[model samples]
Target: MARPNLTRPNATRPDAAGPNAAGPNVHRVQPGASVQAAVDAAHPGDVVELAAGNYPGSVTIATDGVTLRGQGNRSVLVPDPADHSACAAAGNGLCVTGVADDRGMPVRPVSGAVVESLAVAGFAKNGIAAAVTDKLTVHQVASHDNGLQGISVEMSTRTVLTENEARDNGQAGIFVANWFDRKGGALETRGTQVAANRLTGNRIGLQLRRVRDLTATGNLASGNCGGIFVVGDDGVPRAGSLSIANNVVRANNRYCEPNPRLDSVQGTGILLTGTEDVVVSENLITDHSGTSPMSGGIVLYPSVVGAPNARAVVTDNILADNLPVDLADLDQRNGSSFMTNSCRTSQPAGHC
Candidate 1:
């Protein structure tokens, strides 16, 4: 086991140099200094303390076990619109990727990474993505106004995304997706915890896709197209389990035809597709605007072949005043089951 010392050797001084000390280095990286220069100079467990300014550059964290903090989320690591094209191929504004699988999938393991206290915004892609690395924790990060998702944890396990705020992204706020290159399977995103997030005004708030034994709790999602999208795949969603509890999802729109030339999504509050062993409880879902002729507050549909029985236990929820269509539309073969709850307009009386 590694030593449990919180202080890294080179972290003590910004200019102290040696083998035992890369020198307590406080590099004030301006337009000329590369972001990779700061990262290369940092030793393991060191702190890359960014100044209070807009860094119009890209940063890739290659070292393990380091802390990159800033004066505040608002002033540090501001995305430059000019660099938007730089991230078009990578899929994230701040990309930290690892190895990929034979089926063109990123393989993530749980250990040795932490991204905290950075406010990343205004790129042409997802805000921050950590792929194929684990034991990772992203906290106090604000990601907004990106081309795609605010934050994406693709093929990652044992990750904790907490206290993050995602808003006005082109796609979902937080996405946990797996590559679908191989026919047999994509690896599971197990033991992942997404808690205490404030997601608003995005296409989809939180999408837990193809991950088993995942938990999304204590989050607030509002004014998005959909609040939470839990998906299961033909090969993976059958055995996966998603736990969505203690969230406040409200004012979302299902089948939203924002303009006359756009397509529509199916469900508004929670769209469960091709997954099993899901439990959505203790949530407050209200005021969803549905437009499609076949839309619902909560829709559970399966899209796999020859899979086991998919099950979703939805209880103790306050789903009220959702309209333009049905409240719940379930169309899978013996679809996701729901027990004693309230989809009524009123809470105690269960009026719809």
Candidate 2:
């Protein structure tokens, strides 16, 4: 689908230059100018462009229907020294969030926002985050070496993370979670897309904690702790109407956080912890060369997390099965189906 070019506003055709091409609604920030100030100054349908420089402090975007465009990697934001004593300030580099009321409930939602062409790194939490927002788009951004997820959508619906590069983050590169710990309610993600992204050297490439209508496609993941983690074990419902298709996942379990509970380090091409009704199809799952039985082409951790993952379809995948097991449905959760899979070893011929 063709998105409206925020640069032209009324123009039906998308302009290649976007808001950077210069217009009345475009605000340019110099090296030391505060990005948050520019966002505060911008109105709806406005764009704030950051010039190339190292900025300090978290940039809060309380505005709605705005675009924050950085000058590629040249625009960097470090942790706010005031917020923390050290570099890890525990705040998002660029935060698109709404205001809260007296009871700490969100009274407003910062919707229809876009953060593009920024190299977001360092300073505590996610490189870019949207909390309780809707229709947010993150495009052509390079987020790496952050404290947490490179890009995070927490309690946000209708979000898109596209053409982004996430690497060397402390946590998952791209994370879509309900933030139930903070919000505490029944969660249902609707209309979320994670496409054409490259995630590497992170704890997990793409971690989907809980989502209903989720689509993750045409992404590349490698040399991470894991790849394509479909998790919803704690208290969230199993993910339904989800699709993880046409992705390249390999060389995971490369870095394992030492934990006493698990005796071995484990990772997989696709780790379906406690998700159901998910269609994992047309993915090239291969070369998961790790020692842990948990590390394989495809893994299903049943009964270990939430109500055992049931009613899933694993089909049309190329599995190298280099690890201990290619696909493990050992407990065989009810309605666990498999079909049309090609594997080098450790898989039955018949479809399950």
Candidate number with greatest lDDT: 2
- Model 1 residue 49 distance off true place after TM-score fit, in angstroms: 1.8
Q: Report per-prediction Cα RMSD to one decimal.
A: 4.7, 4.9
Worst 10 residues of 2 by lDDT: 10-19
lDDT per residue as tens, model 1, 75-194: 445455455333434645666666776765554442555666778888777788777766677888888998888988877777888999999998889987674223435346667889
Per-model TM against the reference = 0.81, 0.86
Each candidate's lDDT (Cα)?
0.66, 0.74
Poorly placed runs, candidate 1 (over 4 Å): 1-33, 79-91, 105-110, 180-186, 237-239, 254-263, 304-309, 324-327, 345-352
lDDT of 1: 0.66
Q: Mark the regions of model 2 whose C-alpha exceeds 4 Å error after superposition.
A: 1-24, 83-89, 99-107, 180-186, 234-236, 258-265, 303-306, 347-352
Q: How many clashes (backbone atoms < 3 Å, residues ≥3 apart in a chain or on different chains) does model 2 have?
A: 0
